[model samples]
Target: MGNVRLRQLVIAAGSLDVADTLADVLGLGEAFLDPGVAEFGLVNRVYGIGDQFLEVVVPTALTAPAGRFLARGGDGGYMAIFQTDDLAGARARADALKFRRVWNIDLPDISASHLHPADVGAAIVSIDEARPAASWRWGGPDWERRAAPGKLTGAVITSAAPEQMAARWGEALGIPAKGGVIRLADATLDFGMGKEERMVKFQVSLPDVGAACIRAARRGLDVVNDEVRIGGVGIVLSG
Candidate 1:
């Protein structure tokens, strides 16, 4: 582990339009699509929220990874990405733990390794290493300048064996499991016990949760108790 931080969360959606709806409810804008990403048989949109990024990937081919994941779990949270200083070292550790690298991207400024979710017994996790660490190429230039109202604070994952899954991810990321949460440099992964394993929610730090709920309502999104469901994942607004 070397200066690891939660960088981005990937949502596999039925279409980019669905992703746009969710982004509207969250007040995230300036969506950027990379044709290079589409060449990989997938279409993607990245929204800037503070220094962090939120991406939605939709498969254009039946054999695409996103499509397969959508088939297994439907439209929902699909991957959690961590920015690390040592991608090679991280891959070595993951290999030792019997984690498989299903996909990768290697470039002059950016590199990544995607671990198989089935082997990790959780959601797909990607170890990313970027040149300046603050700048993400996938999100395009001046991502930080994009209009956004809140910061991503945390993500929620549910598993039947919460403790076991937490411990496993903890060991893999070299992060200590404290209670049900795995603390990262930028955010926390809150593990909750559930009947099945899945990414269930995300926490955003906004000025007013109630006002955010009202905003979502105005966008025609259903809100309850200051939380709304977007593609099987709960968007929880908090101060």
Candidate 2:
């Protein structure tokens, strides 16, 4: 079986207006509010950065799954969703590794799966696959267009033991470790920042970080202008 590949990262928020504000400020297109595809919830939105996507999720009383995630995660951080060429094979590997499946959702056009934190030695790790029109498009109003000629920079994963955390990500993602980070063609996943009560940070490449921050701040988001760095790995707020 091949190692799981990092596909997308998610951030949970309290409202869609906030998400829309961030999207508009980022000069992202309309990837957020398209209804032709399945709408998970009113507060749930997504923006396509490149091959990978950044999602902003909001809990709704009507949507049990989103509500549950909000209740469990408490605030926000990096909510990872990995992609695999072979779903059954990946599941088999996870099973062999004794990872417990926490949530499983099978829609008409897509199948989403997740593993428990105990299994991955971190927060929830979700897996998904595109099924025809089931997958949503990346460019649209209220969405950030992929930074032309840009790629995913890196993601920060916090763990008590950085070396062990790196190894676990290596094993799960089927990538090799280099300088405490796993580098992919388009992105890097940094592991082992020490476990603490905080958020996971994802450092995405952008043409203009200052502009992004300005846009995010205008949307009533708590924008922190610190150069991207991870200690306990706090929630990533795209500016």
Worst 10 residues of 1 by lDDT: 206-215
* Local accuracy of candidate 1 as per-residue lDDT tens digits, 57-91: 88998788778878877888888888899888888
Candidate 1, residue 158: how far the Cα is off, in Å: 1.2
* Cα lDDT, model 2, residue 171: 56
Q: Of the candidates shown, which would achieve the greatest lDDT relative to the real structure?
A: 1
Residue 19, candidate 2: Cα error in Å is: 1.2
Model 1 vs truth, CA RMSD: 1.7
lDDT of 2 by residue, 52-131 (tens): 66666665563545555556555456367776555666566667777787767666656666776655665567766545
Whole-model Cα lDDT per candidate? 0.82, 0.57
Give the poorly placed runs of model 1, Cα more than 4 Å off: none
